[model samples]
Target: MSTSSNSIARMWRTVLPRRGSVARASDRFQAGLLIFVALLALAALPVSAAIGSETYVRQQGESAQQVSERSQVAATLLADGPDITVNSRAGVVGNSRLTDAAWLLPDGTRRVGKVVAGQGRLKGETLTVWVDRTGSPVDPPLRGAGVVIDAVVLGLGLWLGALALLALGYRLAVFSLDRFRFAQWQHEWFHQLDRKTRS
Candidate 1:
């Protein structure tokens, strides 16, 4: 199995573009590590979201944005269409027959509507909005899956970093012990050499 795997790896090396082989391998390893980390973070995202903390706050914000957009579109459409007598609140105040366009804000109610560019007055059928201050929903919304992805990625990085640190620490400890052993061996050798010279 090992031989076959080695042969396959050699085959891949031959097939791949000839550049700096070491660099290419390092780059590939780095890319693989990054992908691994991302997957882990993704898995962790859900757990974080489940806490119903900042995640919930952000979700609510997105929802509000979606609602607001819908409301704006509704208002704009109200002026665009003919008055619906069946629905009293559906249509606006003036005949929003928009041939030209203009803006109006004589009162605190700032509005732009169909009016001649040079014309003084602005006019648009003011339709009664049943829901006021309604915010827009978060389109392309983030869900649990997204949350999970985020968490998994974060977790993966932490895990990898920890593993790396452990490996490094182990290497350092081994190196220190080896150096101490070598010093002791060298001291003993020196003493024997001196005794032999005296003899």
Candidate 2:
């Protein structure tokens, strides 16, 4: 049999009951299975890490490209936003409000949109808003080490979770084997005691 098949056979042999004899095969099988699962999980960690690192690099590059492509333009608030006094006692609730505003594009064309601003902003107050080349508002993208950190965190979390699960499975398997053995021993001891008492 192949190595994997042999290992499986060995594990199965340990779990199967033996007639008229004590069976310790299950313990061996549990131990062997635990080792196998541990090794397999360990092997997967590197692959996951590599994939995560690659994802980080890709995201970092994309963010940098966005940084280069996106531009911040000063847009004026066309009118006062929602009243700040509405929730003053409750501590600033939804401090930003959308108000109509206008700004000049790089091509000297006027662009008007609803820009977010402070609740009590006066008319023509300058607010910095990010925009893409088409003058459409966009959120700033993460860059540099931020992408790297996020990727590492995600990768490590998944890898650790996988390892932990494998270990837990191994523990449960071992516990099951121990329980079976204890039951078997108890049965034998009771049978012997009964015979001795009858003699």
Error of 2 at 132 (Å): 1.3
> By TM-score, how accurate is candidate 2?
0.71
lDDT tens readout by residue for model 2, 1-199? 7999997676555556456535466665765687689688989799779878888988988998999889888898888877775555777666777789888888888899988877778897898888899998778767777898889988898898888888888888878888998999999999999999999
Clashes of each: 37, 2
TM-score of 1: 0.34
Top of the candidates by TM-score: 2
Best by lDDT: 2
Runs in model 2 deviating more than 4 A are: 1-23, 81-97, 118-123
Q: Against the hidden reference, what TM-scores do the models get?
A: 0.34, 0.71
Candidate 1 C-alpha lDDT tens digits along 101-146: 2222223353433321121222343332322232321123445566
